[model samples]
Target chain A: MNNTLKKNDMKTAYIMLLPIVGLLTVFVVIPLLYAIFVSFYQWSFYQDSIFVGFSNYLLVLKDQAFYKAMWTGIKFALIVIPIQFVAAFLFAHLIKNLTAKVGGFVKTSIYIPHVISGVVASIVFMFIYNYNGGLANYIVSLFGSEPIPFLADVKYALGSISLPAIWLGFGFTTLIILAGINDIPDSYYEAAEIDGANTFHKMIFITLPLLKNVFLYVIVVGLTGAIQQFDLAYVMTNGGPLNSTMTPNLFIYTHFKNDPYMGYTISAALLLFVIIGVISALMFRLINSKQVED
Target chain B: MKKPKFLAFMLTVLFIISSILTGCSGTGPAGTEEEKPDDSSDSGKTVLNFWTPQWGDADKEWWEKNIEAYNKSQDKVEVKLEIVPGDAWDQKVVAAQAAGTSPDITTMNYNKIIFSAEQGKILPLDEYTDPAIWDDLYENIAEFVTLDGKHYAYPMLAEPSAVLFYRKDMFKEAGLDPEKAPVTWDELIEYGKKLKKGNVFGLAAAGNAAEYGWTHWGFQAMVGQQPISEDWSEATIVNEPTKELITFWNEMYQSGILPKQPLGGYTDIKPLAEGQVAMQINGSWAIGQLRNDYPDLLDNIGVAVVPTNDGNQDKPTASLGGWTLTIDGNSKHPKESAEFIQWLLAGDEQIMVDFFKDVTKFSKFTARKSVDEVLAQDSEGANDPWRKLIAEEVVPYAVAEPIYAWEVSMAYATALERVMLEGTDLEKSLQTAEKEINDYIKNNNYAGTNPKK
Candidate 1:
């Protein structure tokens, strides 16, 4: 009788899973496979795409501008990720420790930027960074320093642009970290306190270790988001002041959006996709393995 | 119980499938009788989709008024003007075209019109328009819209390239005469030096490559010296004159008369409008903005022709910047669109021109020669300096940029950006660009291929 019930349960489970599996196959798997297929062809909007094998890959590899854009993307992600993570983590930690009402207010304030549209944020940033009479320059003047050309200089353009991205991202990331911290039990901290662990020690040994999963999650997600950055760069710089801020995504978009060179853009996009996939997979493995050992 | 659950799920799936099949099988709104209006000739009933790039608030208001007037004037077509913001306009238009769901009439820049026409996306108006209509437009303006002996668009307006605009009040405050505007390159440099101060800049030239940078200002200013050969073949004209312009601009950058290293010109227009700049070399459109947005600065502001190498230069050659309205080839209402275009272009629609004119307050030269006198009469006023400039100086000296296939021109512009911003070796950059462009042309089979293919 027990064996018969078990068999019946197994059959019901498989039936329930069938529709979901079919949907994934139709939507995600098929489109991804088709994109991969198209990436190998020499695509043009006006004519038939010819089979080009790995020539598109070769072309992208040989292109100097593409490499420059890739490097820029890496630098942008590197700069923005750490700043965003630490700031967000601290804010979240502070909010978690605050009175409920105060914490809610702080959370609301920080999350406002996350809600603002990227284009709107970029325009506002432009005004603040304007060369003359801009808020940034006005503040610089108070310090008796010369105004910096935030958007126009190659030296400062990338950093200046990353400011808005970081500002826009910090709020959401803080909320995520705050949620993760709140999920930790009070009993662990109480035990540490009873054992005479100092506040700093409790945080370092217990809080940080317990929040590792959340930190890893933020890092990986943040890196992927930064790598695919487009709207901020397009709105603020359009890859200007010597293309100092040009990212691979912007390059792909410009080609596809302005002139429809579908084949080249698709190839570039596929390359980026592969890079993102490999990096993300490696990150996931490293984080998961560390978690397992811990 | 399990069977009933399965049956319910299957029924839901069947319903969804049947709905999708029905959706696919059903005739589109375009083909269905239900799509047609019950009263086709009903007053204030027809819907016309009009697309334009975002202009500032004043310009938007003006356009709204003009469109409203047109709708009011016509009993049939009620035009709906949709203003796409600058950042998304290009992408939106491209997507619309790809989806085969573009608006009936849309505005496109001269460079884009050629490419779109070549792709057979836009209708050629030559068949729909009378040849006599062509004779009325400024000769160069007419030539710009014509490709392969076909008219692809109606000339909307032509904005002359950069000219020196100065603050008369600021000049006086700086103890310089306003009437004697800078006439020679050397004089301009000196004037800029004189105007430089703790807060104010002498001249504002767009330095950011993203905003078309110094190329639009410096390159076009040197147009008289470097005319593209009658046949648009090579950059043979990038000779001594081009080099001189580059050297002069670089020297200006170094002189401390202009803004410091990593100069800000492109994205920030407020600096000039707010009187932070004593002088600015900008497009004719700036005049309209100064009039509308900076009404307080009216008495202080003055316009002047750009300085040349010597007084011998006949007139300032400004870069021709404008848009042309074209009907989509795939449009369902070509007849209506063509008629609407004709009505828009008629001399009586000077109000429309006035409304659509940029900050510079310059209207496009009318295609009909008969309207020239009327345009002059309409524009005659002390308050309307931009109108005068457009009618007199800009219309004559304006020249169109060389047209290439879409990809080639974009590649060329990209190359130009690199050369200007990175200070790349000009000859090498041009060589590489020329090679890349030619290769693209050959691959794409763009028009004006050299050596007879």
Candidate 2:
């Protein structure tokens, strides 16, 4: 009787898993496989596709725009990752230092930006970065600096776009990191205090080492998000000011519009996926190994 | 425990049943009326799907009103209107086409009309549409909707063609003739210099990557002759006329008459309307927007043709851009679709006039000459004689962006931007653009105006 009940439970479990498995197979797994398959073909809308046998990949590899766009992505990641990590870590530390009620209020306040829609966030940032009467310029003028066309100038456009990414994403990062910081046992800091360590020393020697796993999680997730950044660029600039803000994702989108070289776009996308995947896996492994060593 | 398990099972079954019932109930009312084959008379009405980009609030309300009017006008056919938002419209249409579930008729960009027609996604209206209907469209505007001498779509409203809008107050402040617009490139620069005050710029053209930017509306004015070879097989940007065009615009920028910052995007005439710039080159649609949104500035604003280079004074400098209503080739109900298009765009003069005056608030420039005539006679239009002037004068001179590829146009735009913004060598940048465009044409095997032997 117990065996039969166990069998029924297993059957129910499988049935519950069925919807999720089916969804993955349809939306994620199938589309990914198709993208990989199309990467090998010379495809266009309503036109006969030819088996190009990795020619599209070769072309994407050789394309100057592809390299420039990837470099832009990398540059954007570099700007976003360090700044976001530091800011989030600092804010999380500050929140952890506060009383529960005050901490909760401050956390919610910081997270308000994260809850705002990406498009709305981008528009808000656009106004802030506007040359004519933007908040950024208005503040800059108060400091006796000349007005800057943040989005229009190529020198500043990429950096201008990055501001919103940091603003929108740092709140969530802070929340996660704050939770991690809180999870650190009070005894570790208590031990450090008893050992004659100062507050800074505790933060460096005790708090920092304990937060490795959290940092690893933040960096990997943040790195991936930054690499795949699309919405902010699309809504804010449309990869303009002469494509200075054109990340690989925007480049892929532009290719899709052209239609004739869709295979080329798919190839570029696959290449970006592989590049990001390899980097992320290596980072994850390296972080895991460090944790193991500790 | 047994009782709890039994209750859960009962709840699960009830949930499933309720869900199915709710699903049925959701569509039940409409299904009975519309999906019912039992009512043969109702089934006889051919429902044709029509999709258009949701322009905005005013346009959406107008579209819904007109759609209802069209539906009530005929019992034999029912037009179901879907106002897809602009950003999502392209993706939706593409997906629909791929799935063979596209609307019977849809509005398309002028560039996409040729590309879609080439792909056989859009139907050739020449077969179903009257030849006279095509003949009545503004000739230059009609050329844009035609691919390989075949009409793929009907030309819709063109926006404010790249006409120079000047602030008469700003002109007066500069001690210049408030009524006179800059007639030539030199005169424009001269006026721009005088117009510049502490915060106000003398002139502003499209400086960004948007539709009004240097490459599009700006480049049209610069194309002294056409920018492509007569065959569309070659880039004419490498030539002397094109060289002179880029050089002049660059000089204007260098002269400090133009703004340091790029204009925000399309519909960014704020600088001109706010008196930050004395002159701005924008589309004819700005008149209506000015009248509605900036009524205070309407009296201060005057419209004129975008100043051309001395050699091309007779040639209109504005680029014609607008939507085109095309029938899906795969549509099951083609005749009904064509009939609806004919009624709204071509045949029904009253409806077309309402579409402009009431629906679009005279913001959208009409493609049909007859509708143009009627709207020009209407109260709103009669007060603004520039409507007729733009219809008769500016539109004829406006050329459509070359239909070869988007990249080709971007190449020209990039060259101008590099020279103007980044201070790249104008000649070298254009030479590179020419090579790139010609290569794209060759690689893609594009058929534009094929050169005559």
Candidate 3:
């Protein structure tokens, strides 16, 4: 009778899982497999596709544009991730110490950007960065300096574009980190304080060590988000000014539209996926190992 | 009691699931019926999906009104207009095509006509379209959508190539002829120098290669010639004319005659209107924008054809930028779609007038020569100086950018960016563009403008 009940429970669990499993199979698994399959062929939706047997991969590996885009993506992530980490941690800690009503106001204000669409945020930033009669140039004029081409100059375009991403990201990251901080038991901080720990010492000894998992989550997620950046580059610079702001995703998207480059586009996408996967794995391992050592 | 309660709960869950499963409330492509009110054909009207690149709210309302009119005009067909956002339209259409769910009729850029046709994405409308209608369309504009003596798409509006719009007041102040715009490239530079003063630029030449008008139309004026071979098989980026074009742009930048930042998109005429720029080159769309937003500046604005390098004032130099309505080859209702296209673009003169004058407020020019005549006779356009100038000087000279693989123009845009932004040598940049374009053409085996067998 117990075995029959166990079987029945198993059946119910499987039934419960069916809808999500089916959705994943249809949306994720099928598309991924199809992309992998298409990567091996010279495909254009308009024209007949031919089996090219990994030539697309070979082409992507050799293409200079591919490397340039990948490096830009990597540089973007490197700049964004650390900024997000420090800002989120500091803001969350400060907010956690505030009075409840004030904290709520601060949290909501900080979280507002998270809800703004990337395209909308980028457009707002575009006005700020405009070369002719932009807010940035107006400020520079006050200092008696010539106007800086924020979107036009290759040197400054990437950073100018990054501002929007950072604005949108830090808020969300802070909220997550804040939640993680709140989940930590008050007893640990109390004990640290009793042991003659000051606020900074209590944060360092009690809060930081305990928020390891959250840190891992934020950093890994932030890195991936930065790497897949598209909307900002699409709206603002359009991977222009000598392709300084071209991310891998932008490269993939541009090529994807060109039709004849379908094979190359898919191959590049898969390669980016693999690269992201490897980097994320390394990050996870490093973070987990650090936690163990602590 | 617990068993009974559990049984009741399960029965309720089953009832809800059954209702969801067996209910015919929501059916047939989740968004099809709702997002489009007149989508399904249950009312005995054949529904045709029409997709357009999204425009301003005003344009959207105008389109909906027209679609409704078309629907009500006859019970035989219901044309549903879906306005897709401009930046995302191409991707959305291509994805829909791949998924076998493309709209019956769609709007495409004039440059995309040849490539899309070659891809079999658009149907050749020669059979469905009336010859007289094609004849009525502006001849120069017609050249864009027609390939090998066959028209692939219906030309909707003609945004004539770059016209040198200058502040008449600024010109008068600078002792330059406000009546005659620059007659040559050198004259424009000279004029720019005269106009440049403290906190004001002579010209709003975009230094950064961003918009099509910034590079393509500017090159068209500078080269005073076509940069592509007649066959469209080779890019002439390394040719003398192209080099001269690049040199002119670089010199403009070096002289500080142009704005420090790239003027960006075609609609970027704010500098000119704000009096920061004395001269700017843009499409006729600016005529309406300035009239609406800056009525004070409207009287001061002077529109003239972009001058050529050789001082050939009469040479056809305007680069035509516009949209075309093409019937999707995958469409099941080709007849109905063609009828709708005809009604909107060709059949009704009143509708055409409404689109160009009433709706867009003369923001866009009609592609139809017949409609141009009607507009000229009408009060709204009769005394309009910009209208008269565009109809006579601009529309006649407008040339379509070489409609090769979409990548060719993009490669040119990139080359222009390198030359303008990075201060790269013109020769090297053009050579890079040439090599990249040739490689793309050969590698893709695109039959770009080859003689028909």
Q: Quick one: best lDDT, which candidate?
A: 3
For this target, which candidate reaches the highest DockQ against the unseen true structure? Answer: 3
Q: What's the lDDT for candidate 1?
A: 0.69
For model 1, residues B146-181, the per-residue Cα lDDT tens digits are 877888898877666666688898889878997778
lDDT of each: 0.69, 0.75, 0.77
Candidate 2, A143-236: lDDT as tens digits: 9886777877789889999988999889999999988888989999898889999989998898888888888888988998898889888888
| iRMSD, all candidates | 7.2, 9.6, 7.0
Write down the DockQ of candidate 2. 0.26
The deviation in Å at residue B257 for candidate 1 is: 3.2
Q: What's the ranking of the predictions by lDDT, best on top?
A: 3, 2, 1
- Error of model 1, residue B115, in angstroms: 1.8
Model 2 segments beyond 4 Å from truth?
Answer: A1-18, A42-48, A192-201, A290-294, B1-44, B56-58, B210-222, B225-234, B357-365, B372-383, B446-453
Where does candidate 3 stray beyond 4 Å? A1-18, A42-49, A96-101, A179-209, A258-261, A290-294, B1-40, B54-66, B138-140, B173-177, B205-218, B221-235, B359-366, B373-383, B446-453
lDDT of 2: 0.75
Docking class of 1: acceptable
Better of 1 and 2 by TM-score: 2
